[model samples]
Target: MDFDVDDAATLMALLDEKRPRRVTQSLLSGWDMLQTDLPSRERIESATAVLVGTGLATVDEDWGMLLTAEGARIRRAVPGRGLGMRQIPGILGAQLRARGVARADLTLPAALYDAAYSAYMEAAAHREERAYRRHWWETWKPRRQR
Candidate 1:
């Protein structure tokens, strides 16, 4: 969802309510708060573009793209915040299963620890690769000038 600063701010405000909100209502409320003309369908579409670009929201096949985990975390960390705790264990369990974290293996405490450690190491390696790429770009550009 692409949104500008105004729209982003509005979404953040509504998220503070910690209640499930419809996309349409949220858009309307945002416009109301801004004291601007009501948003047309086209305007809403444009705002969605901004929101998605900024990584503030995402869409899922099951649940139309709402705020992402990072967006939720930001909402929670805000002062005087009241973010909802959506259980979503099904989502986490599904991700684990997709990553081959067997449910039966979890029953064995020792195996569960080992599986988790392996997954953590895999993620750390990917992160390190990204960091290396970023560092290389930052360093190589300057050296090439000489």
Candidate 2:
């Protein structure tokens, strides 16, 4: 499957949120960081299929699309694993201080950190881009001008 960064991010976020087990609907609902636009049911299903096919995620008769062992490993390797939302900014600040570079300046070796970082950044950027677009449309742009 030719899944893009955003798709991988969505899968990973879903796996993180609904760890251990999750059905399709639950995965969709729990994807707060990545599903603001809310893809059609067809798209969600297709993405799930791709994730499973790639072995980044797994599905059972009961659990729709839970993380595989590989997936868990990837999650744990993320720069700020086990941190809650409230702690992310602080953790990122600490990382930046320790590294002597901006968080955005850091890049992981492709062999080691590529998959997890790719997925995380994809989801994060997707949300940021969506929010920017929404603000531009709803607040920045004048409706009368349009």
Candidate 3:
């Protein structure tokens, strides 16, 4: 599933160090806390829908919404978009700048870890790698078995 900037922003709001959160309570507040530029409520809701459809988020009536294990894993793996030496300072500056004026996409944060990540994922899909890992886990012993 393709995740656009809106989807990214929505996911950011939902993620609270792996804690469950009420959607209505967390959505706008997270953006404000992070000094993110305001996106329309509809936009945020739409993004949430996409995330749910992709199995990245689960909504519980009692506990609100939470990121699934896969969601959190993907989030952790997501690399910043433009985290170059010169860009680092600018990204920081933007975060501390005025909220609405701040461009949410600045520093191009997290367009998903595509380059090396894609290659790694592709390689991991091979059965040979899985077999090797399984064999190492099942057969390898640090000391001689008695």
Which candidate model has the greater TM-score, 1 or 2?
2
**Model 1, C-alpha of 57: deviation from truth (Å):** 0.8
Tell me the TM-score of model 1.
0.38
The best candidate by lDDT is 2
Clashes of 2: 0
Per-residue error at 67 for model 2, in Å? 1.0
Candidates sorted by lDDT, best first: 2, 3, 1
For every model shown, what is its TM-score relative to the native structure? 0.38, 0.44, 0.42
Q: Report the number of the highest-TM-score candidate.
A: 2
Kindly give the stretch of ten consecutive residues in candidate 2 with the minimal lDDT sum.
Answer: 100-109
The TM-score ranking, best first, is 2, 3, 1
Off by over 4 Å in 2: 1-5, 16-20, 24-26, 81-146
The local distance difference test score of model 3 is 0.45
Report the C-alpha displacement of residue 133, candidate 2, in angstroms. 29
Shift in Å, residue 92, candidate 2: 17
Poorest lDDT segment (10 consecutive residues) of candidate 1: 100-109
